[model samples]
Target: MKNYFIVVEGLDGSGKTTAINTITKILNNNGIKDIILTREPGGTPIAEKLRKLIKYNIKGDEITNKTELLMLYAARVQLIEKVIKPALEKGKWVIGDRHDLSSQAYQSGGRNINQKLITYLSNMVIGKFKPTLTLYLDLPPKIGLKRILSRRKIDRIEKEQLSFFVRTRARYLEIASTDSSIITIDANQNLKQVQHEIYKILNQWLKIYK
Candidate 1:
């Protein structure tokens, strides 16, 4: 079977990590053994360093919008060129916790960067490559933030105002609406229900792809 790159996308607290784990287990049980799980902005060593800067902003220096956008692509390209593409070339399936759509939502919507710029950067960095499947867990920003706050310290991006997330979420929905490969799942439901939906989707996909 051809290798598949699956991505799980959601707000900070929408349980994407959990969903990735469940999806991994589902694939393993279904006989897909050659798999790698990775997250954006930190999959490789250099990218991990960039992740710290982007996520924590430990320097406390205000990062400009353009700088932030460039840093994100820097980390992403490193991950893709060094890790994701290589693994795919080796016929290993990859499950990503987040992917390119994130920049569209966070950078373009949250930071109000122009979509054209984002698209241009994306073309330069990744060209026509895209995930085989993307699962977007959709939830209200307030609830998502509350969930995030309950778990751990908020990161720099997570510290943004509610309105920022609202705009981000709106962009995610808008993008998902136009993309057939992107699957939107209601993340407001109970944990088990969300997982069930994901499993169902994966199972159907497997029937066709595997």
Candidate 2:
């Protein structure tokens, strides 16, 4: 059995979670049941703790950009090592809600960190391991913000200014443009339309896999 690592990436309220669920269902319907569904920033125990710190200011002080970036990588490496890698070795497919691309968009793009530095960090942590397929759900920050605000309370990262998300989205597009492993989907359409597009992509990919 060939293991697959599938990553779903997008800004908040881009419907990544819903898309992952739908993808999982489709894969299961296809008789791919050895699947591990997870999310970044907190997949493992230690990573979950780091996620809380990163998501909320539990210490009552602002987390500097560098600190936030490092902590995110810390959580990510932990998840990758303790869960994702092992699952893959066991021949289980892993579906990720978010992945390293989020850090590139949010930390390097939104926070104005150097891209080369981020690349170095990524190489150090994840090395040559990359997702088998990445689905990037693209949408405007204005619309995504509206959808999020209406759905739930904003977290620390979500509370950033609209400009932050704009920068992040731009970075996401830039990275996706150069990465052959990434497939960008326009998420501005209706829910059914978006899911249909995702299904189409997955169906094509699975056909090739066979």
Candidate 3:
């Protein structure tokens, strides 16, 4: 059987990292031997380097939407080649922190880039290997922004205004609504409650995978 490709997505600071980590530990404890937790724009060596360059502001030149979109696909290509495909071939669970939906959200919704262009570019780079199960941690844009602000300096994407995040979120919901594979979970709940919801989703997915 092909291994599962599970992608967790949301606006920045939706407790994605914590949820991912908790899922990792839970899967390990459950004796899911071949589970691998990885993320986009930084999974492989080359992609990680590119991630830093794209996210961090340069001294003078700005990272435009087109360049940002291209770089994300570039990283995704390397990740698919070096990490995602190989691991699934070896029959391991690949839990991704983010994936192509992020491109759709940030580049298209936030940056006002063209969706068709982004889709075409992503397909050329990563092909049709979309996520089998996408867990969208849903939280209000204001809440996410506040959480993000408490953590680190704002990157180009992070610095985007409240209006941008709202659109991104609306787009996420719109897409997920039409897709059964993508599951939306409330992220504004407390951390433990959020983790519980995740565990519930994983349990349901495991039934299909098993």
Q: Please, what is the TM-score per model?
A: 0.98, 0.97, 0.94
Candidate 2's error at 10, in angstroms?
A: 0.2
Error of 3 at 75 (Å): 0.5
Candidate 1 off by > 4 Å? 58-60
Question: Model 1: clashing residue pairs?
Answer: none
- Candidate 3: pairs in clash: none
Q: Which lDDT tens digits does candidate 3 get at residues 41-140? A: 8988899999998988588988877988888888988998898889998889888999999988878888889889988887787778888889899999
Question: Backbone clashes in each candidate structure, one number apiece?
Answer: 0, 0, 0
The total of clashing pairs for model 2 equals 0
Across residues 1-210, which tens digit of lDDT does each residue of candidate 1 receive? 778999999898899988999999999999899999889889999999999989887575888889989999999999999999999999999999888999999999899999999999999999998999999999999999999888889998998899999999999999999999999999999999999999999999999988
Of candidate 2, the 10-residue stretch with the lowest lDDT total is 57-66
lDDT of each: 0.93, 0.93, 0.86
Candidate order (lDDT): 1, 2, 3
Best first by TM-score, ranked: 1, 2, 3
RMSD for each of the candidates: 0.9, 0.9, 1.4
Off by over 4 Å in 3: none
lDDT for predicted candidate 2 compared with the true structure: 0.93
> What stretches of model 2 exceed 4 Å from their correct place?
none
